[model samples]
Target chain A: MAEVNNVVEALKFMALGMGVVFLFLYILVVLVKVQAALIAKYFPENTPKIPTTPVGNTVEDENRRVAAIIAAVSEFRKNKS
Target chain B: MKLKQIFISLLFAMIALTSMSQATGQDATAPVVAEVSTEKKAYEPKTIAELATSFWQTTGINAIFDVNDGETTSEPKGHAYEREMTWFESSLGRIMMILIVFLLFYLAIAKNFEPLLLIPIAFGGLLANIPLAGMGGEHGMLGIIYNMGIANEFFPLLIFMGVGAMTDFGPLLANPKTALLGGAAQFGIFGSLVGAVMIGFDLQSASAISIIGGADGPTSIFIANRLAPDMLGAIAVAAYSYMALVPVIQPPIMRALTSKAERVIVMKTTRQVHRLEKLIFPIVVLVLSILVLPESTPLIGAFAFGNFAKESGVVDRLSDTMQNALINIVTIFLGLGVGSKLAADKFLVLETMGIMIIGLIAFSAGTAAGVIMAKIMNRFSKEPINPLIGAAGVSAVPMSARVVSKVGSEEKPGNVLLMHAMGPNVAGVIGSAVAAGVLLSIFK
Candidate 1:
């Protein structure tokens, strides 16, 4: 029984190639996960993320803020004049 | 219409074709032939008719029409064909080849398909087909550059280096599970290998052609040069052309394989990757590649060096060079070197057709395989994974990633998958390198 040598060889390449690619990448996944863990544990960033600024809770505060903005603009304009 | 009526334009075209390559093929081409007339000293033309006749005989039209002209060792400018072609074969082949070059230019310009490489390659091909020029022959300029870079395997490795230098592996480092999608996409290469063998190509050529599934032009050229140098032109053209068409080819396969719900699935971004982790990444990959598959070391080593230079932060100048100037220069030479193989004898064969068809099938199969693999992963995955991102695993780089993102968002508004697709996109690059190594280990 003479099987075509090309087919046999091609089948070998397919199996080995797919197997190696999967195996290599699989190991890489594990390594990257481990490396991420090691890095997070050993050397973390110094400053934590900044929190969003909290807004004041009343209408009086909003009015005062607007008046301050207008006063600052007018005072700057008077100084320039 | 042509059978009954005399076509004036067709007759003129035929007449035009003959006059182009015959100028140096006959008459005054050889000293002995000119001296055959013993009556006149030095064979001088006494009459104007005699002078015109001699001049006309030297025209390309005469050479093309002369079917059984006596053998000459060298072409008009001393370029000899290694495979002795007849006057008709040589001249006719060049004519057909110039037409093919025009189509390549059209694809690059009008169609906007891979213009950067295609323009240079088409120009090289245009020069290669000039009658009796032998610009693509061994001693010619294009041929010398071809030997210096492509033949020795440095050009592809250098390209991989540029790719690595520019690639951001943070997305891949953040999500390791997506690496499986990259590995799964390589099934297209192996699967295409079987199909190519069945289609009557030898094992070496089949392997070279199948690498087109990787969708990375440099790797395809590298393997083609190694395993099947004769088919390099066809494989490179097919690989680059199909890659440009990825945005067109991938979506249909991806849609067919995945359900709407799977496509719409939203994935959560992984935690931030540390700078140290990023720095060590290329070294780990390089070391591992050498340990497991030394055959892949050249590709992987160059890629790692480029990434390391970028990550080191101190060598911004070197990194800048690798990613820009060096890569651009290599690309021009690489394109022309590949185009040198577009000589009519190599390109006009039936095998080129087989390579184009196989390349298309391989690309589609790779996209489908990646999608299927992602669907499987979603079943086991605790976090919801969108199957669309898996289609980016064929290593078309940012192109496939962008397409995946576009396709994913088309299903569900505001469902961004570009960053997520990048994880598998980069993984596919490494996966294909490993696959190429395996193929080399088996054959070499």
Candidate 2:
């Protein structure tokens, strides 16, 4: 009976140890968060400006135009040569 | 005219000499031919007497007579040869099973059922199933690769390093309270342990069984390999399958536990993390985790080391090697090795089904626990908290975060929970690793 009780106590301690370790990790994360918040507040950098126009369409259009222009220029050079 | 005639005649003589030489060479190489005076005929047995005396009698009494001859005959070939060929006799069955695996791969890759991992996994499966390809056989290429990594637990740990390199711990550090949810979510790990033990699995088998709840493949494989290498195939398949099915498995439980309003609650944007804080974070976590749970040091240590390399900014070469070259090489070996485990004899069993079913149970329980813990925390907390982010507590990394975002946006489109969800998302990685360590220490 004493041996059984000892085993149970050991398991409990094990669980408790895990819980304590988890609590410590949680505290560390909170400390990092608080520190980051303070630093950000102290040094306020410019927010990235968002362009109003949609992204993929404009990029695709630019690429197409550039390709056409390069083709025309190459043809002109070929004719001259 | 006389000279032209002489040249033509010389050409003719040259052609005749060449033809004669070629004929002689062909005759020398030809098989010895014998002429028969009469054509040989097959013996036609019109009666029992004729059949009994025929050359067919050489096959023994079984081949001596037809059924119409009124004689019971025994087969000349023994049963041993038939028994030996029984495994190949079911060619259709083997082909069908291979087709099923191929279809699953197709669904996984083409239909985007975890394409990043499954595409390569599916290709590996197809390669292994090729008849006599010997990918799964002893001395085979895939067999050698599998033995080199999967059996030794090298591939999975290397994968963890790559995962560590890719992960940005900034979100996790930006909102620490989410770590509680990560811890709470690990109830599934214990739940699985109890369930497995109840089913008569030993401590080591139970440990492998329970890691399915971690909802992370490398962690599951690592723990499984350490605790119970015999159960590696089942545990790995369960882990990868459930990971692919996360979007399907998690939503219902997420909906059941939290109200629509709770899901829609917007979390505050995380503040910018400092460079110094980012640099010190992995070191602090590693040291603390090791001090508390020394058993978890291997996984936690490797993870922290990889992250340290990434965050330090000075070890760009080491980080790059871990992220690209090492990871790519490991992925190929791991996929083929894992596929090699899917051999017909070992994989085709009821235990495989049990592993998959229990894996789903573990995932659901983890998700539910995280949500409930979040709601409980929300009751006491001053700041607004989104319970949906709790679902990201599983260590599926960006996928779990993406699921939270998708679900949260469905309730409130403008509510961006991805960054906030990332806190618990990363924390879940640590939580599972810790749980894996606990299991390893207790079992090993």
- For each candidate in turn, give its C-alpha RMSD to the true structure in angstroms: 9.5, 17.3
In model 2 chain B, which range of ten residues has the least summed lDDT?
A: B67-76
lDDT of 1 by residue, B93-193 (tens): 66787788999899889989889889888887776655445666667777777878888988999999988888878778878899999999998899999
Alpha-carbon runs more than 4 Å astray in model 1: A1-5, A46-81, B1-81, B86-92
Candidate 2 error regions (>4 Å): A1-21, A30-81, B1-97, B127-133
* Candidate 2: docking tier: incorrect
**What TM-score, computed on C-alpha atoms, does each candidate reach?**
0.83, 0.71
What's the CA error at residue A33 for candidate 1, in Å?
0.9
Q: What is the lDDT of candidate 1?
A: 0.80
| TM-score (C-alpha, index-matched) for candidate 2 | 0.71
Query: What lDDT is reached at residue B427 by model 1?
Result: 95
The candidate that wins on TM-score is 1
| Candidate No. with top lDDT | 1
